[model samples]
Target: MLRHLIARFVFLLAAICAPVLATPAMAATDVSTPWTDEDFASLRLISAQTQTGSSDTLRLGLEFELQPEWKIYWRSAGDAGFPPQLDWTGSQNVGDANILWPAPHRFSIFGLETFGYKNHVILPIDVAIPDRTQSVAINLDVDYLVCSDICIPAAATFALDIPANGNPDTSTSGASTVSTHAHEIEKFVSKVPLTGDNLPIQVSNVFATKDGDATQLHLSVDGLSNAGVTVDDILVESPLRIGFGAPVAVNKDGESNNRHFTVPVFGLNADQDLASETVTVTVIAGPLAIEQSRTVANGPTDASAQGEPLGADTMAPATGAGANIWLIGLFALFGGLILNVMPCVLPVLSIKVMSAINARDGEISRVRSGFLASAAGIITSFWLIAAVLIAIKLAGGSIGWGIQFQQPLFLTVMTIILALFALNMWGLFEINGSDNLGTAANDVINQQEKGGRHLSSHFMTGMFATLLATPCSAPFLGTAVGFALAGSSFDIIWIFTLLGVGLATPYLAIALQPRLAHALPKPGRWMSVVKAVLGLALVGTAIWLLSILAVQIGLGGAIAVGVGLVLGAVFVWARKRSQNLRPRFVFTALAVTGFLVALFAPGFSKPPAPSSVSTAATGPLDWQTFAPETIPALIADGKTVFVDVTAEWCVSCQVNKKLVLETAELAEFFANDDIILMQADWTRPDPEIADYLASYGRYGIPFNAVFGPNAPKGVLLSELLSRDAVLDAIKDARSTAGLASN
Candidate 1:
């Protein structure tokens, strides 16, 4: 912000005083300084007049010509980056100086937008000269940022001396020869936008549609009626999560040359809704641009951070934060059911099968109760997770699915619990209803062993299944979760509960029809073999978690934790069969002590292991590191970009890579030079990547999108990608011009 620059200018003087980049371009004129020689861009100072003469004002410009695909920010750089600042502290005979910013073009990539200038631009300035009779010396110290693939901070010193007016300066130039930048100065000076009433654009009317289920802005502009404007032709800037989307013409009046555009409001939350703040709106039409500001009328609203996909068709229609909960609920249910087959859920399925087998010999009523308890547990677990997410959302923190796996402490805890479960299945130690520690839950429900199994045991199984299911986003899960997370707390609860119910559908059906339990084969010696196999599956899960823990706290910590679990299992096995005096006390203490390393060894400070995406691995195709800001400029140059947002921890992402993205056919197609491939690694916590995901209303991985000259908003793929889906999306993105809807 300009205010930030002003507040910290004094502290930043040392850095600002550093010399500019050497090797400048040849001086354009005696009134102009040489351009700084930088690979990405070059800058110079140009004066329109060689002498101050009788004129009270001296005109100059800071001219910059950027290399291909490079850009600099406007006065208000959207999303990220800052504008250039000039310090004239070492100047003589200058009373004041003012910078006039040229109109900036909006860069649209993925779902976010930024404003800047590409190619060449000049920022015109006017100086107030109190004494035109005296020689005026101008020294400009400029600090600015330029970005292409990376952002580089640049500084330059430019000096231009204006000769004193003796004969009132002959024609304001010596020997009737004007400065070389005279024409360029006039060209950019005309490009500066007019302010206030001088601006051609007018906000004819501003109104908000606030209802129980909706909060939106309906704007009517006087000059742009039926001007054929798309969402790309406008830019919105606000310091809040919720914002107005691109203007869509709802009604047009050719007779009056007016357009009533309905703007979809996105990401509105409980705290900030753009209600009391000013929103800067910029409209771009060919070479003409105009900016205006309108303060939203404050009102009571139920808007939450959730918003429908922006630039959908025309209206981008949506109602309130809880829009289309019924559809979202159904999607969640189906997504949850599909989680039953995910790779991460395989171990839990074994545990589930063992429990089912043990209950097969029990009475039908007892079997039904156990299944019902498990189903209840799944729903209760979802509620617990939803509660935490809601709390984080309310407190303004980042929240995402499977994000818990990013924590070392959580990984350590999961590893120990899985190991213990494996030992129990291996018969290292037997747990009775008296031995159960579910006291808090036992009070509400009878946990006493009825038919050799307690309800608490079954309930815990369901809860664990839900936890494991999070790593791989099941089919339809991303949509349902994105919708849920983007909306109110109620939406999250509703969707997640439906997801739990969907996942527990099989259990619920068995509970409803107790006869299913009676139909299982009678318990036999084969059950023991099945238990061993199930135990192995759980042990494998523990191992996988250990590998991830190794990345978090180093291999040594993981080995120590693994050793502790093994020793703990050894003591547990001995406690069951040992004949020594005080064997129970000794074995129990030893087992508990073995598990202690896991509690204190893992550290959360270390980042997760780098994934293929993070490393930007060399493949058949030329893959670029994810840089969202550069996407639009690439598209402007008529190139297609395919972006894959993935993480190593995401099973679905690996599946997509093997089955769709890395396939021979798609690989060959992407290998084409025109097709730009960018991969983002989300293995570690990255605020930029998180914000990008949130922009699209997604909270999970295996995300894919295609951007091209035709598709400005890009084509969003599903969590699970298919060959046909990938081809169709890429083709559509490349061939179709401005396909606004997914």
Candidate 2:
């Protein structure tokens, strides 16, 4: 019995020491043995010789071939599962080793989205060879988890040997064994995400803000949106012991072509200083993926920064601030003065002209009362606009100039008003016994007979003019309106009042100068001709309003409105020609019914899908539909972008497009492959476009801007675009980019 126990102990001791003695010999040569975990996965150790800079590096690959529906975790194993951990202590002549991970896919099992790899994957271990004169032996004991429906832990020991200076002929077979595994290792090297300077994507800015107990990272990526690229997952790779939730895209107010991602980070200590920490973000967009590193700043470092804390008490400062308030007010004044010439406001001009003509025969007191009422009307409308802006701002909503033009209801109502006014000008109807001002002699008689009501008409005309002018933006108006909207409530009111004052300046001058009215052609047959001309202008204005209505509603709704306007016009004409009071009342009732039908008919139809209305040719310089998210990418790619923010309702925008942008000279210039012409049509209500407009501090359309490599922030163009102006902007942008590159 004693002899049997001694023999058993010797046998067990040899069994334990046998594998340890054989490890050195196994590692001395390339030990490639296939490892299988049941039927789920198969892994093997492979070795290759690679050149990194001036060093001969030994590349060892832990290649895994998984069965269908099975997957393994990535380095930053999100949600669940552990990444493969390697024990390199048993390896020889290996100064250092690193596992290079490829970009992972987001797997949604149940309701959880986990990051892992399916099918075949190779985890490349770059072994640093300390001495080129000596062979290097690598041994790895890896512990990894694989999952199908359930996860299973597996362990394996892998060994590989690389000859001195990667020489294969020194081996026992005198063959290049490292070359045999070269293709397999190269396959995975290509799969590894581009890092550092090799990354194709560019990160513009990264910001961190504390939201309750979690931290939100606002990442702004350039060119991602413009390329129509969308990310599936963003993994935060950092040494900090924190957990991150799935990334949610946050659309910045004015940046349609730029991508903004909001990533929620947990496990942040209250006292942690985010400004000093570096973060690596791996973005996987379709088949392409990139890894970029950036320092997390406390606040937004760029103008595109968004995703602020929900409970913050104060509003962030406006991006535009340096302009002098007095200068902006002056611009507002000039813009208002120029607004008088816009087609939308031309109908109001006729009213002003008629008032001036009527005042030519009246006393100074009557003229003063009439002009003062008009001025009061203008000022009151401006104040009302200010009140609406304040209400919107206080409610934590965005406010822009002429934003009402985007509302279908507002457009419908304005169309009805303009249509009726046009009919009145056309002698279908008369207001306050004025006889539609069909003849100058009749107008003179009416003004003499009803002076008080005539003054009221003048007042309403001024209010109507101001209302119409809101849809058009003039030179310097953007600067003024931007300042006002971004300023305090009091500033908004004060600045808008100044704008009204500017608009009324011409009327005030005419009222103060009685000789101005005398300079007009005498009230005769010429008055009839002038009335007809003014009536045509009003009709044109109504048509313009309806065109916008067509975009807001649909073609069907627009047709209905046209029919309603015609019916209303016929009834108004019948009422004007009627001799009996009952017949006139019946005609008036018909007109009212038609007007109501016109106003609400659009509400019943579905709005048509917005389509691109760009006139640029589909060639090298094809006009892209304006997407704010994509602008960054275009600029980054060294393309000069010309952005035109226009609307169908804006008369100035149409004028600019017809007169300057669509000209042969401009078209030729835009045909350059390096130049991208993009149009943002604000013909309908679009929150994305509205927010983009607000970002530039503009609330109105006909906004043109240029973006280039150097001017990624963009340079605003004049409201009235000229051929020279656009060409000059492009030239300047190119020159700026050249300078920046130099």
Candidate 3:
């Protein structure tokens, strides 16, 4: 979201630094200039072929490699520093050298967000050759700000020559091409977002809105459908020098390929005229990058009062309230209620079931109290999450539901806790109050203390349930969370509270009617078997998290954690089975050591690689990657398309797959030569899938839709899908624009 709209703003003074101490020389390869060394950086001109043989233009690259901690700024350079300035005045036979900057990574240091490239970066520049038969002598003078703990301005000059006439060598793809720095230059060139009409991503609409002292940019964009890749952040390059913060997706539904965003405009007063201005909008979502020039228009003012994000005004309550807020609150409640039934929530559901069964023969007072404690736990945990999110928002950090799953540390801790729960469930270890003091009277005291301990555990159970429920987005939950995330702090706090209440509603209901617990089977020998079965469920959940860990870090880190947990489980089993105290002590020591590995491994491990690679669609159902833009064309051609937006962590999605889509009837229907099945996997966080789900105003997964001639837009399916619903929708989709032909 770093756009250098710096016409009026004063640029940071780039202090000239001392000469580059020492560095290894880089080979020129004839087509490229040797590394022009600087204090903390090296610059070079690189090209695949020096000759412009059979080519109209000479493709070249200006590459920079910085010291370990130094970085060069992007176009806008963020809150501090300036982008590199290149002067090609001394060049010969070069019409105009246009340097294309690749997308930059955002870095926040001491509360200031900056955009730049660290380590190595290449700015691909295409030097237009006016005369094809003339030799081009390219001379470049570059000045840039490179920063680490401090900012330093460095200058360097580089030169390269492209000879006139020689038959261009054919590349591996059998095309006349430049092949010197071909792969390296092409990679950097690809990083440069597509512009003009070539952009797959299209900005449908853009407008500016102002409220009080705050100005905002509202945008509508289309063309985002990439598997596992998240296309979220939007940057604005305005001709009027208007600065825009990173835009967040507005949870509101739109057309299939389109999504909306709201950006906070910096250094713009409410009095400034914003309409009719031209700006280049760059949307970066992992590998899917595109930019478009848009004419600004006026947009609808906020129905409610707004304030600057991360400002004191934001900390206060919003003055005006809208009816939609209430509706969102209701949705939040319903979403939370739905979460209890989500397949991913089974781990905690099992705990609640056990609590109910144990209470079946217990005192009514204890039953009510235990359930209330659980309810309280859920409510308290939700508030805690809200508080944290509020803080993050205030700090201008990216915030979202279920986003914590993306963190390796969070995944590691969760795996360890769940693994221990599984071990305890399997009777490997029994949690009791006394490690010692085995006196008869102390035993009586322990018995007396059991009730209170059970209640506390019930609360913990509710908290754990809330944590597990995050990965499953129920229908209303996504809308409510999205609404809150985009709204004032009050909205965030209030909506999340409603969601907590909604999720705890069932628990509250059971508490109100203690007789319900009495209806369940009383405790018996059968309970132990149930616990063991539930233990397997937790183990499965842990394994799923580990797989995500593998994706986050590397396979090696994930294996380290997995092995630790498995060994810990084994040690627990031994400790319980062994009769000797000495053997028990040894088992305990070994178990702690094993569990510690899971605990500390992620913190010590290196971070995951800079990029994530998502593979092409592969499945038995002939499921292609979900591309909503392609749907209209296929439907135009009389083909029926079924789009399934699902995530790996979504258990309900798996259930729907087993019961509906993957069923023989639907399978055969989708396998039809005319039928196209597209699946958007939300196994990893994906902005496109999220936006697609939001378009229908449905947030939670297990989302499916069918499109055809009759249902050109799409026919939505139930959240908890059924086989009949799937077939009926497909049938409806296939129903004729003219007449039913299938």
Candidate 4:
């Protein structure tokens, strides 16, 4: 488990690079400007109109013709520059002025992430003017950073005169030109999609579920080409939801739209849903777009016109009496049995299988004790996990397995444990290392420890092994866990506990039968060799721990962790060297302390905060933080956005990033085109990312989506990534939105 965490950390470090460069031109429409030599310039705001239900919504534009090669910063001016700011405090009869920015380019100047636009750009503003006011005067105060090799700050205080007259000949050619430009930008914005409606994806319904006591959003989408889509493509926004990889393709019902996409509700991974009201969906299908705001009413409430229920058939027996009780128990048992084979427990099992052969001669009572101990271990571990998961779920946390690693303290604990095991295996210290006796004495010690009749140790070992195995859940296990989280609290707890029992049953059966134990080879010197091998396995586990350290502290820290392991070995050696127990105890304590401090040192360092305003090619982008409330606004604006849900430990995510996302080609494409890129990192198992993943019916990494015009909200992408795949997916999504390459 530690090894996987380290790999994920390394992947994230290698994956994230300088921000992708966006060409400001992508966001701006009909960008033209009047410019003079040197650094001076002016931007003009024009009027455009679009009809709503009753009145028309006013669209204003800021057109700037910067000197060639000169640039202006976006809302998030990246590194050292300031973004353009506007003050409409003095405007008359204008209810609101919302600046619409085009996506901005990313520049790594002196190792800084800068967002800006070059040449000419137009910033369109949405204004809600009073219907009574024929024309409203526009006044503005603006500040911006312009760069041409070197950067310079500038501001403009300007006003436009308007006669309190009729809606100023909007049909004229001049007005039409501005309207065209505004509409062009709207093309990009319109892609943020909505929920509901029968799409090519065919969202049959969206439902609220309690999976293992965790709140989840379930979206049933039909028409899957294959079951692989269940393990890929689908993505959810909220981090607090729970999901498997993707919606599992149930055996097709043979209907054209029988494929269902089960996405966990956003912010529902908690024991209780954290949502105040409403659910927003940005459905992106190759270029087809739909963005809608659906109210998240009562728990799994009847489907509204805006959001559909997952499926009426999906409702399990509301009355528990006649439920498929046998099947539920079978699922639990199978889930537990499968967990034993998961990556997290593999090594532990290896040790146990090897150890079990020797314990065959033990007495029935002893064997029983060992089995009970193992059962206890398994139960305890599962309970602990359940408790934490439930706590977080109740708290509205959005995260899944290995979430403990997010805390430096947890990483520190694992580091110390692994180091000790490694040192013991490497022979730096021996368990009862010193016994000034002949070879025969060691054999006697081994026999005594095994206790011919005591089977409890072996059983206990099994349980302990199972407990340690929780980190890496297998595929089916994730599904089971997700199901457990969605159910009632008691049911969640019982299901997990039952899973533990099922996992231990096989071993217990063998322990209970003396005939099974009597069939083993007689104990001898070979036993020492076997112990030595077990020691080696322990060392391997330590190395895995060190790998995780490398990610948190870099390669240098890994070496430090290695040193701590060595120190632990020395302590073990010292304990063996002398009969005095006090010195040994002190050395052991010191070794443990050193390992912990080294593991968490990197977390202490702080990083800069991300800015809200982002400059894109559309003009000036008014960046909005991701939230349940922001969906309505994003849909209304109609901008194509690219959302990345990443983690520090997700290796696949890094591969996709370095191999595809960081390229200049992608950067150029996103910038020149009015696309918004939003990144949500789960470097430390963030609740937010968890919520986001759950929304898509997943509990781990490598989640992605694209929001395009006409389909402006979002479209989930595949889990295993390829640059070409993403590009094609985006292109296809764009095409669905009535957009075609010219």
Candidate No. with top TM-score: 1
- lDDT of each residue in 673-722, candidate 1, tens digit only: 66799988765556457557876678878788998876667888888889
The residue-by-residue lDDT of candidate 3 on 586-642, one tens digit each, is: 887898899888867866666554332223233457778566767888988988888
Off by over 4 Å in 3: 1-321, 391-399, 430-454, 547-559, 600-618, 626-642, 671-675, 686-700, 703-718, 722-741
Tens-digit per-residue lDDT, 1-742, candidate 4: 2232343334222211101111121112233223323445556655443221123346666667788778887654544677778888888766767776554444544534455677767676777767534656667777777887877877776675433424443322211122234432343333323345535445535555565754555454444343212222333333333222223233334433344444433223344553454444433333233444444444533233233334433312112322434345567677677666554565575456555665566666665565555666566556756766665454433325545444434444455554544454444644332345435555764666557433334434553465345445443445556556654467568767877776776666665674665577887777767767777676676566555545444666566656755665666667666567678667757755665545545455332232232111111222234443243355455445667665444444555666677667775666634455666654443333454555445564456677654454466676455678777756654533324432
The lDDT of each candidate is 0.70, 0.69, 0.69, 0.51
Candidate 2's clash total is 12
Per-candidate Cα RMSD to the true structure, in Å, reads: 20.5, 27.0, 16.5, 22.1
Clashes of each: 3, 12, 5, 118
Candidate achieving the largest lDDT: 1
Candidate 2, residue 625: Cα displacement in angstroms equals: 1.4
Per-residue CA lDDT of model 2 for 161-262, tens digit only, reads 655644432322222233345444655665577666423456657878786787877787666655444555677766787766667766566464666777
Q: What lDDT is reached at residue 75 by model 2?
A: 87
Model 1 worst lDDT window (10 residues): 18-27
What is the model-wide C-alpha lDDT for candidate 4?
Answer: 0.51
Between candidates 3 and 4, which one is better according to lDDT?
A: 3
Give the Cα-based TM-score of candidate 1 against the true structure: 0.56
